[model samples]
Target: MTDSPLHVTVKLNAKLQPEHRHELFEDPLDALLESAELGQLTGGGTALTDEGEVDYGDIEIALTDPASLPGVIELLEQLGAPKGSLIQRAGEPDQPFGVTEGLALYLNGTDLPDEVYEQCDSNYVFEQIVERIEGVGEICSWWQGPTETALYLYGVSFETLRERIADLVATYPLCQGARVVKIA
Candidate 1:
């Protein structure tokens, strides 16, 4: 496995928005590979659900390391994959973490103005989350939809991440009824 070119599909957390997921995971993933000398990130074309039918979040890196698999999983736990997360492209390994096994906080975007607001301001939901989750977690991805903004966080312990952001979820106007779902 070490000598041969192997396919590693590191299935991500399920709660993250399935669109453009590469942006959420690519930086850390590339750094890990480069620092560890694992392999290069050969870009993949547009991803699809069924034979290029839909817009799929696609990111590609190369490797086939049986020995390093456990270590890989450990490092990637920040992305919410505490268990084994990779699958062989050639189907060697049978199971991979589900695309749905992840966590996210959905904050209402209704009243939030487009203007920039202070960190703690209810209008600036992203900054508020970033400030509170200093070490607990990092927002990996976010989706600003018609109704709400889904903030996908990256962290080791789900409990800690929740604790760090609990106050905002409870008291803040925009986050008053925020939903934090941990699918893992």
Candidate 2:
């Protein structure tokens, strides 16, 4: 099966007061889309969710890769938006690692395959790892932290997954470093 597109939810807490919420921007949706990198804003009429979760507005976009998530979040943050955003598999996002800060991989069990907890500081690089080793065991659950992300996985062996992780670390940019830890 082909890989799923990234479905992202970006929430914005506008810097405006309630009375002036309508004046947050001339065209808030347009203002938001200007900063996007990989995906485009899908609809035309009213893309705003008006879900009341955000003080301002919320928009959803579809991206080709989860790796582009960091860029999307960065743009939203710059505009005082995306207080927090989540990405999921376009198809079955509600599944494990389906939603997360920047990106996540929720896995099963402890004592990973080879005592190897492959990780990198850059979400972009981590996205590469996800792309390379996806569709193994169950979906990966990830927690994107300030400095790094911890990815929990299952069903895959260390020798196999590690080789690909190592190869990605060696070949890609933004993933200058990686660590494999044994969680006892």
lDDT of 2: 0.41
Root-mean-square deviation (CA) per prediction = 5.9, 16.5
List residue ranges in candidate 2 displaced over 4 A: 1-3, 15-37, 43-56, 82-184
lDDT values, one for every candidate? 0.58, 0.41
- Model 1, range 4-101, lDDT digits (tens) per residue? 75556654433344444455456677788788887656764443334222222434667656566566555555544523344445647555543223
**Sequence-dependent TM-score of model 2:** 0.30
Q: TM-score for all predictions?
A: 0.61, 0.30
For model 1, where is the 10-residue window of minimal lDDT?
A: 47-56
Q: Rate residue 65 of model 1 by lDDT.
A: 64
TM-score of 1: 0.61
Off by over 4 Å in 1: 1-4, 14-38, 44-58, 64-84, 95-102, 110-123
Candidate 2 residue 4 Cα shift, in angstroms, is: 3.4
Per-residue lDDT of 50 in model 1: 41
